[model samples]
Target: MKKETGRPTQLITRKFAKELHSNFMKYRASIIAKYIKKEDANAVWFSVEELENYIHYIKSKGEKTGYDVNGIRIYFGVYPEQRKYAEKAGLMTVFLQATGKKIRKAAKEGEVQTLALVMDNGDGDISSIEPMNYGSIGRPPSLLY
Candidate 1:
């Protein structure tokens, strides 16, 4: 229970660890929701770089499981500021709607699936390029497919 530095793990039980994990998850959800809402209000398109920066900012707050590039891209829509930059950089930009209790509830209920829709604006025409499923949060039966 004691560490090399003399800290005691006994001071923190499994229950504490579990509670901490839950709290952290809640905090992460809140942060993601805040940023998403801000983006929605501004009507600003975010590139992958911007997303990464956002992730980094979150991590700086001592949050674990900070946004993984691949993981995040699975649920947000890509809207690269400069299509050429996205192509040259080999990354997709995206637009993320604010994550709300409603969406979270749907995700948990299996009534809806969170998807990352990638758009390609070629010749000034916006079109769906790809869509990726991130994960389901709700009921087991509803999450199928």
Candidate 2:
């Protein structure tokens, strides 16, 4: 008569439970990060070529933004969702740009975020150069982006 013990279990105490939860979150995040691409999880990925094509398409339809350039193009005017976001921020409009030549030129070195382009033939693509906080005109030093 001997009693046998199998595998040992971690006793989840209040303090140990907190540590266990924190460690589990870290481990889970690491596992998920290994499987997820940064762009896939956080942002939309579009190519320069795609943008160029979209620009050409819009231009063909006579839709142009004031910021169209060889590499960068921007479409003005607020869309329904964008308008909602802007309204939430108490803004009448949110000037947008793609991370192209014009956007780089407009944004102070780091103010620009990744450009998001959503294609639409009817209203043209929706392009947003985020952290939309810049001006377009000023002396040689303060032009908007």
Candidate 3:
């Protein structure tokens, strides 16, 4: 089989594309279902600005989608510095690859982190505040400690 450099020829890439599409569909459906089941009509999952900022931030760092988990597509290579900004914007569950392997905050390798909101801090500035890890189910003290 001859391999094409620019375009994918009859190879495993086709199967992988199909798999990604299927997974995306499932994720979309789950999100819709969750929203529908919610009692509050004004309930917000994520705002447009937040999502746009997240995508922009992720792209700015040259990080790509690592994988999809629970309807959220995880992107990898988000450094500790970038993680704070992403988390402040409400992006969590970062992964190292599309295989769904997670990454931890401030980890050297194979670390996993789940970002959460700390508080409004009454400054009306989410960016002004730094994200803190009080600890969670799957997290351990970062090497910084």
Which candidate has the top score in lDDT? 2
**Which pairs clash (backbone N, Cα, C closer than 3 Å) in model 3?**
66-97, 66-98, 103-111, 103-112, 104-111, 104-112
Q: How close is candidate 3 to the true structure, as a TM-score?
A: 0.19
Candidate 3 local Cα displacement, residue 22, angstroms: 2.5
* Model 3 regions lying over 4 Å from their true place: 1-11, 32-88, 97-145
State each candidate's clash count.
10, 3, 6
Give the TM-score comparing model 1 with the true structure, all chains together: 0.19
lDDT of 1 at 79: 37
User: What's each prediction's TM-score?
Assistant: 0.19, 0.19, 0.19
lDDT of 1 at 33: 44
Error of 1 at 90 (Å): 16
lDDT of 3 by residue, 1-145 (tens): 9856685464667678767656644664346446644211111134566555554543433223321121223332222435554332222223311122222224234545645322211212122112222112122211110
Could you tell me which 10 consecutive residues in candidate 1 have the lowest summed lDDT? 97-106
Model 1, residue 106: distance off in Å is 68
* Structural RMSD, model 1: 22.8
lDDT of 1 by residue, 66-105 (tens): 2212222323343344666432222223333211111111
